[model samples]
Target chain A: MSPVNSPLAKKLNSFAPLSPDELTCLADLQARRRTVAAMTEIVHEGQTDHRAWILQEGWANCYKLVPNGGRQIIGFPLPGDFMGLRSILLRTSDHSFASLTDAVVTEVPKHRIDEIFQAFPRLATSILWAMSRDEAMVVEHLVSLGRRTAIEGLAHLFLELGQRLSLVDLVSGSGFACPLNQYVLADALGLSAVHVNRVLRQLRERGLVSVKAHQVIIHDLDGLRELAGYDSTYLNGDRPAR
Target chain B: MSPVNSPLAKKLNSFAPLSPDELTCLADLQARRRTVAAMTEIVHEGQTDHRAWILQEGWANCYKLVPNGGRQIIGFPLPGDFMGLRSILLRTSDHSFASLTDAVVTEVPKHRIDEIFQAFPRLATSILWAMSRDEAMVVEHLVSLGRRTAIEGLAHLFLELGQRLSLVDLVSGSGFACPLNQYVLADALGLSAVHVNRVLRQLRERGLVSVKAHQVIIHDLDGLRELAGYDSTYLNGDRPAR
Candidate 1:
């Protein structure tokens, strides 16, 4: 059975407070539903064209495959997340996005998205805001990868994901279920799988974090914050008015 | 004598036409100018407040410093480029901006910027567009660092810079001065200084490029493009409806 409510629809409303009629109208623009098994490719690199996908449920990973067959996972989008926006302008997929779990998504055609942009300027503005924010998150990631140590890098990522998920009510506070695999974590952190496992063990030993079969509990928020040198200012979507 | 005009500004205004009045208004906003010798710090990490600066002329590096003294150059801004916008929303400067060469810049108080944003929505929108483009460039950089080889990383940077500078007429075609030292290149490319020298030597040996003093001449554009896998679509700023 599919998830009854659309978390993405709610997210869209939160940005602009669209009415029910508008939401229903907007949802109708998307095409038929699609599903992918866990660890399946949703979009591939070097693909000339793309169809925009709105995640109905499940998680997806957006990444680039290196020429040497190595991988670098740039981002992981949860429910309500949008990928394929790059295709909206570039006429191609710049990076491949794959499912991390059984995922239900709906493809939105480019022509319809353009129509929506014209019909709903506020929605388009919200999208621009979201994409710009996505870019800022990339900025933070660049800073972390280019500057932090392995442990620090891992801590920052955890803190980041926790805070982001919390904003959308996914997590309670300092902890979230990190469903991604260690190999994927390695790619995200620019480390080997062995290195990522060793770091994870070190964190567990230090009482900084606890990870089990499917959950990660950040035991020492303050310690993790110190290790990550993390400040929550970067996560704020609202800024002081000019 | 000062260059009398901003080359980069001219290139940008080519796409989005600005009146002489608008140009003069921008020049006025940059009235309070200051010049720093080479290796001067423009903004520092952990700084509590925002102080905006415009690159008037010369080279500068924006980077984050780790506790162990490792540095990661997030980007290099040229003349007419704006820096410190990240701090505008974050309320604190998390990374440092420093000049690589004797440089001149103009300071605009954050309050003044805020005032302008409120008073002139068009100017504000233009700034927003500029920042969006900046963020897009960083995404490309992340892909390069995460997925490309060291040689390919350097090649992509060169090609990207050449294209960007060409838009500003800084490049005649496939050649332009690097305007940065080997050490700066090292940090920017996430390589050691020794590694940078080796890669440059490799590029030279392969007859792909000739670097003398500060000038770089691309001996093989097609080879460089193939090596970098650069597609201009990502950098294209021409906005279409939706």
Candidate 2:
């Protein structure tokens, strides 16, 4: 792959510039590119010799199966996002990842991380920036599950997803092509499927948001943001004071 | 701070070896060291000149105030842990930090991170590993909130806290000096104080665990681990395949 054409280059450059040499090094990390179908298990829990990827299209989720029989959705990986990159340091995979939609990914060899850090410190910083952003998102999600009410949690999630997907150009600022069903929402928000249905109904009745035909439409974006106390700072990347 | 005497040097070297040069560089990052009283706000929400710290003694928690008036506890920062370290890449702070117990910390200037990564790639990688482990813990907490039942969540949290504190030698394998009150446990586990009271009663009745006079005693570690589906791999650092 040419450095100029690498999707990762486009992604990281959105936040921090990657020098031509760093871009070439990043492009060299990609071992292959492939598309995975929806509902496919891309990485399973406890798998050794873990692999890493950069998402180029569609959405995916990382999850851990509950001993009681269900799974908890960790976070959604979107276009220009990374999947399994952070887990490269672990001896074994701590969680499984699956596709929420048909997904395209660039397989990056986990072994090249050290080389990248040594040869291209700026690129490594950008990678760390990406991981830090991802970590912030997860922390915010934990807050939602622990503190937000059902209505508030659903609203917060939609606003977050909208802002994130908008950054990747996968959706407009107001709406997105969403593949989540009530079950997915329930798992992510720590609500029951029935409770999720009720919250969606409440949101629709209040004219705050709507989900229909695999798309999420926010009729009152400002209202939902206010209700959820949503802030985009955690998801955004800014110039670091080096 | 002398390199040989830096507590962080001892902590990081437990997982990965730091050369004398890297250790000296690491020691240079600390600007000062101080002790803080309990219930003190170490870092406030929305403060722009965000500072970073390495926890040297006692415990602190990062949390966000919910719009509804309560706060959601994000994670507890223990000895050898980094708080606000990841937020250095962020333009603004998203949450607040408070001391759960009287705490000691090493204030590390954020600007020196670029120099560390450029001069010591191995040390940068170790920092990334520590961050990854911290992120994994947050992910696990999210899983507990989303998927685990009342008993399961509390069990999971206690087991996790015990194992983590044991790593820093603050606690034995079976128990720890826990300053978390019922209110703190309730906030962390997404349960009401009343519900947390009931769960504690149940655990005590079942001879699983006990919390008394600010210390937690685990009578049956295996039972709690099984109930919580606890695994220590996420917290353990292993030799990375380069």
Candidate 3:
């Protein structure tokens, strides 16, 4: 995709307009893209580096290893998501980012970001907005793990992913590409793999959703939303796109 | 407390040095203070308001009511912690802020904040740092809920609260004021009140911690940290205070 046609530009443009120069700068940043194989650890926990990355294509998630030999997937970053902006403030990564599939990402050095902030203050505000949105999603995921039931948690996760993908025009009608397996779903939703399988089967039997060829088809989006008590207000979707 | 001597100033100073004018602007913002009784709801979920708040004194927390008729405590804001900065970008609150104790807070109108950003660009960066830090803490809490055992969760909570309180001089030799009760602890840790009581008793029996008359005393801080697998990296304690 061209830089102007990139998912990152589309996602950011959903919040506000970017001038031609701004778009060119963002496009130039993406010109330095690099690809990694599936399950590659892009950055490890406790790693200190002044560089971040933008997910130009494919999916990645952040996770932390538990003391009891388990791992908790903390977040899933979509194509347009910026992976390491949170660490820019602290200069150290607290969790590890691993690609779930063959992926492409653009490394954003600290100096380049500083230049952006210096040249375009408005873009800096938009960057803050993006980081805040990322935090909001994390907060929502916490509620899911702490309060929601197993079924509700699964449903909420699907709904959230669908909504996010929809923002970048990745969703087609009620279906979208979802390459995640039951194990990934289990880790992200705080369930055992067997439990995730059971939940998926139950949802399919109830005509709520179906998975085929690594795609998730939501037959009852409203029903799933109601069951999960999902609300998109936290997503800040109403921000005017200039 | 005077503006410069306020916890908000101290917290902001932890990130970067503020010029006298910047300090005055922050202090002047806090001049319009309001006090609410204990357990008062400051803002409800989905409420749209252009004003944010700074917690000047006492304790407040953000929570969301679950579909199962339970409340999940999303965060506990310490003195000097700014609330609703996330909402400023979204224009709506995703969680409700309630006072855990009689609390003093300063309202910051959005217009005034815009003025601050225009006049003090560096302060704007500091605000971004604060929000990112908040998100990091939430991510940590998510890991605790998803992976940590009940005992470990309780220990982790105590350690985190102690470390945070100590940042504002609220700790004295491993003890700090803890006005929270078992119910509040249950909500925050995803446990029942009875379970919280049991965990507290276990910690005390193990000579790890003790709670008396709204105060928590750490008998073995290092031991508790080890048991909880606690690391303060996410708290950004290494930031230079100016």
Candidate 4:
């Protein structure tokens, strides 16, 4: 994809308009791209790495291993999402990041980010905006896990992923490429894989949504939103007026 | 309390050394303090308030009202913690902030913060650090709700609160002023109030912890950590060396 039409550029532009010069700087900064196989560990938990990454293609997840030998997927980084932004502030990694599919990612060195921050303060502010939105998403996820029912939790996740991915033209109508399997959904929703399958089947039976292979199609968007109690305000991309 | 001895100052210092001038600026920015009654709503969800607040004394919680008339406590901000940092990025509030007890809070205007961002970039970075750590804590809480047992969840909360409070000298000998009652714990842990009481009784009977009035004392820190699978690395205050 051309740099102007890249997912990263689209996502960042939703927050604020990037100047031509700023876009060029960002493209140059991300020029050193690398590809990794599916299910590859990009950054392991407790591994101290100073470089940051931006997902150029495919999906990735940040997860932690529970004490009871279970895996908990905390955050899903889609195309255009920045991974390991916390590594710039914290000295150590608190969770592991892995590719859900064969992925293309841009590695940004620490010094380059520092230079960007010094030269382009508005760009730095946009980065902060992205990070704040990330925190808001996590907080919403907490609400799902702590209060929502199993069906509601799964429905909420689907609606969320659909909305987020749509920002970068990843969604066509109500359907999108959903690479997550039952096990990953189970870990994220805190349900057994069997329960995840059952929930999906129930949604299908209810004519709310359908999953075929790696694609998820929502038949009744309003019904799914009602069932999940999903609110899109938290995901608003409008910049706060100064 | 003196500005230098304040909990907010101490917490900011953990990220980077604050210059005397910076400390004075912060103190000036927080000079407009207000006292709020116990259980008072500081900021309601969807309210468009641009000002930011720092809890100077007493406890406060950020929570959301679920559709089923239940409440989910998203975060319990300690004495030093900043409330509604998202307000700086998002135009409207996503959740409500209420005082758990009669509290003192400092209001800092948005323009003042913008000036600070331009004048003191290191201090700005420190604020980002605090926000990142807050997100990490919420992710850990999600793990508790999704995977941990009732007992393990309560134990983990206690350990986390203790460690965080200790940073500002609020903790003493593995104990601290835990103002959270059973109902609050119920909301935070996604358990019923009866279940919360039962879990507390179980901890007391096992000689692992004890609660009297509003204080919680941990009998065995190591044993509690082992039981909760607690890791303090996420709460580390060490700043990344520049």
Candidate 5:
């Protein structure tokens, strides 16, 4: 897709349905950008600053590193999705995010954010919706870590990532890039690397899916969904125009 | 304190300084209410119907249980905090909440929420602030679990809980009732009960704090805060004030 029609562009357009003139105004906001290599640390845990990043391409995992060698992957950001929304409300971010691939991102300054929220009230509300959705994801993760079995947690995370990426057209059908590696996956799943490898092998043996290279090929989306007890209701977004 | 002068009542009054008439109107909304026992499962996980719960007294925790014998405590809901904000946006919650103590709570039906939102825009905004704070806490926990050590995670959680409870006068000094057992603490911290016990002992041994019979006495609040790397900036309601 052209830059104008990119998923991030579409998301920004959806929030305000920007006028041609407003889109032109947003060009400066768009121009404040950079490309990051895979494994780039976009945000660091315990840092205090206000830079909201919009992922234009590739994927990333926002996480926190716990002591005792445990890690918690909170959420994955896909194309067109915004990270660092917390900075807007809290003035600081307590989590760190790293790119899963060579990715392009646009970073908007905090002052510009205030201008955008003030200029586009509806968009401001939409951003609030975005934050709310992010919170919902956190809640879901809490459930997965707190309640689901290891297999269930893995299946749920896979299903969720697939569904979210698919929603943004980053994935087609049931397959997409796996984003983070097994090491990062271990942190997200609250398990050790060895344990994560064993779970992945069990998943492959069960004919659920395969993670090779960077691609996750879902053999049976429905079956995996069932195994994960996945439900789509938690991921409500603006309905596509009929 | 009388019902009108209660801390929770005063907290709500601080938002808009409700007039006598408005207080009466709001009081009528909770004319019929019930007190729940500690450990009562008030709201089950995966329920679609959402209710706005206003705590008249006591505490509760929103958490989820995994199939693989794990638990994730998402957030501890204090008096004046709202728990089902996700239901407003996501339509369903995958986490269930149980009271941590004998509590009086008023149930505001989801439908009634809009009326309240419209009736008091500031309160509506306050509700949103409460929701945002919960999201902020989730981000902090993601950091605690993902990056911090086991000891830091437990200590951070303790400091956070104490700070929140202190905000509402739940703690007189550095000591406060924890109201959660080792199993629940393990679930919240993503550690084993044995590990959690060890961490708590470490805290005690270091002259940090002490926990006994569901009560946590923070011997050195500032010391615990430093160990946890906690800054109360996120907890501050620094959202759009209108």
Candidate 6:
């Protein structure tokens, strides 16, 4: 596929337009597109090679497994997000990452990244900007885990996802396709599956949001934002790109 | 003080020694060191200026305040840690940062950072490395909050802190000077102050570790590590710099 049509290029063009030459450079890295099966481990904790990839399609969860079969889903790397960038840069996988659904990823080998950084240094800066944005999201989730109530936390997550997907033009008005199930939501929100079910019911009854089948329908985005005290400034800067 | 004499340089020198020219360049920024009183807000949420600082003398907590006066401390910035790099890079403060004790910090102005990035581009790579390390720690904590029990979480945090502090030689064999009170502990660990008190007592009884007054004494380091399942490789790379 051409770089200009790639989800990553499209996402960047939506915010900060990349030059034609930059798109061509990005296309070089996407030469090896591989499809991963749903629920397959793409990278595991303690792995040495520290593989890196750019998500071209579908959802993947970045997580860590604790003792006795416990898992913590840190973040959902949506399409257009870089998977294992930090671990790749640091040269070790600190956590495991897996495809939550059948996904397509363009593998970015370590040497290729180094080549990009040296040949096109500005690309490195842009990648770091994306990483900083990722950290902001993680910090926000940490806040939810530390303080926000279950309802508020779930509300915040939904609103944030809507805004993010909207950036890549994946979310339409009032709803978006969501692949996460109650168990996955429970893992990410630090609640049990039963609690996630109860919270979904509460949101549905209040006409805020509903996770019906495989979609998130945001009935009242304004009300949900108010409940979650959701602010988009953290995700995007004070003045986002036009 | 010269950059070599600064805590930031000392910390880096302990692991990866900086070149003489690099030290001189670093000192240019540290010339504007400022002292802040304990419990003072260095940066507040939603600040437009997006100021940045490096902790040279004391600790600070980077946190986000929710509606109705709830605060969630995402991470504690120790000596040598950049206080607001993520926000400063992204050009907005998503969280508020405050000194936990009377602290000294060296401010890095936005323009100055740009100038350094232009003059010594390699320095930019090192800063990115540090940020990646910081994210690793955050990911680990997210795991604790999501899956680990309170005792296990607290133990993991303490052990992680010890390893981090030891990198700068702030921690001795048996104990370390701890500035966090029960309230702060509760805030960071997602527990109530009463729960923190109980956990401290439990650790004391179990002969693993204890926090008393302003110090944390590790009675049995191996036992505490065993309980926490703590590993240091996440914070440091596979083969860390000596």
Candidate of highest TM-score: 4
* Per-residue lDDT of model 5, residues B1-242, tens digit only: 35554444454554436667556556655665679999898777666676757776788888766544456888788876665656654445657878889988878787776786668665555555556567778877766665577888888888788767766678876688767888888888777899888888899999998998877898987888788876665665532321
List TM-score per model, in order: 0.72, 0.86, 0.90, 0.92, 0.74, 0.90
Highest DockQ: which candidate?
6
Candidate 6 lDDT over A33-91, as tens digits, reads: 88999999887777767568898889999887777677778889888889888767764
- On the 0 to 100 scale, the lDDT of residue B15 in model 3 is 68
lDDT tens per residue, model 4, A16-90 = 889998898788877878999999999888666788899999999999998779888898999988888778754
* Model 3 pairs whose backbones collide: none
- Stretches off by above 4 angstroms in model 3 are A17-25, A89-91, A118-126, A239-242, B12-26, B89-91, B111-126, B238-242
User: lDDT of each structure?
Assistant: 0.72, 0.79, 0.84, 0.85, 0.72, 0.81
Among these predicted structures, which one has the highest lDDT?
A: 4
The residue-by-residue lDDT of candidate 1 on A1-242, one tens digit each, is 22324556555555557666556655675436788899898877546564677776677888876556777788888776777775663345557889999988887767777777778766676555555456556767886776677899898888887766654557765567768888988888778899989999999999998778867789999999899887665545444311
- Winner of 5 and 6 under DockQ: 6
Which of the two, 2 or 6, has more DockQ? 6
User: How high is the lDDT of residue A76 in model 5?
Assistant: 84
The recovered share of true contacts, given per candidate in order, is: 0.29, 0.68, 0.58, 0.53, 0.34, 0.77
User: Which pairs of residues collide in candidate 2?
Assistant: none
Task: Say which prediction, candidate 1 or candidate 6, comes out ahead on lDDT.
Answer: 6
**Cα lDDT of model 1 overall?**
0.72
lDDT of 2 by residue, A72-164 (tens): 898888877777775675445578888988988877667678678677878887887777677778888999998888898899999888877
Model 4's i-RMS, to one decimal, reads 2.5
Task: Give a tens-digit lDDT track for model 1, residues B1-242.
Answer: 23335653564474477666656667667767789998989887646566677887787888876566777788888777787775663345556889988998887677877776677655665665566566557767777766677898898888878776776667866688778778888888778889888998898898888778898889998888888876665555543311
Steric clash pairs (candidate 6): none
Give the Å error, residue B204, model 3.
Answer: 2.3
Q: Is candidate 3 or candidate 6 better by lDDT?
A: 3
lDDT of 3 at A236: 57
lDDT of 6 by residue, B53-126 (tens): 99987889988877868877888999888877766665566788999999999888788877877887666656
Candidate 2 lDDT over residue span B178-207, tens digit each: 989999988888889999999999999999
| Superposed Cα deviation of residue B80, candidate 4 (Å) | 1.1
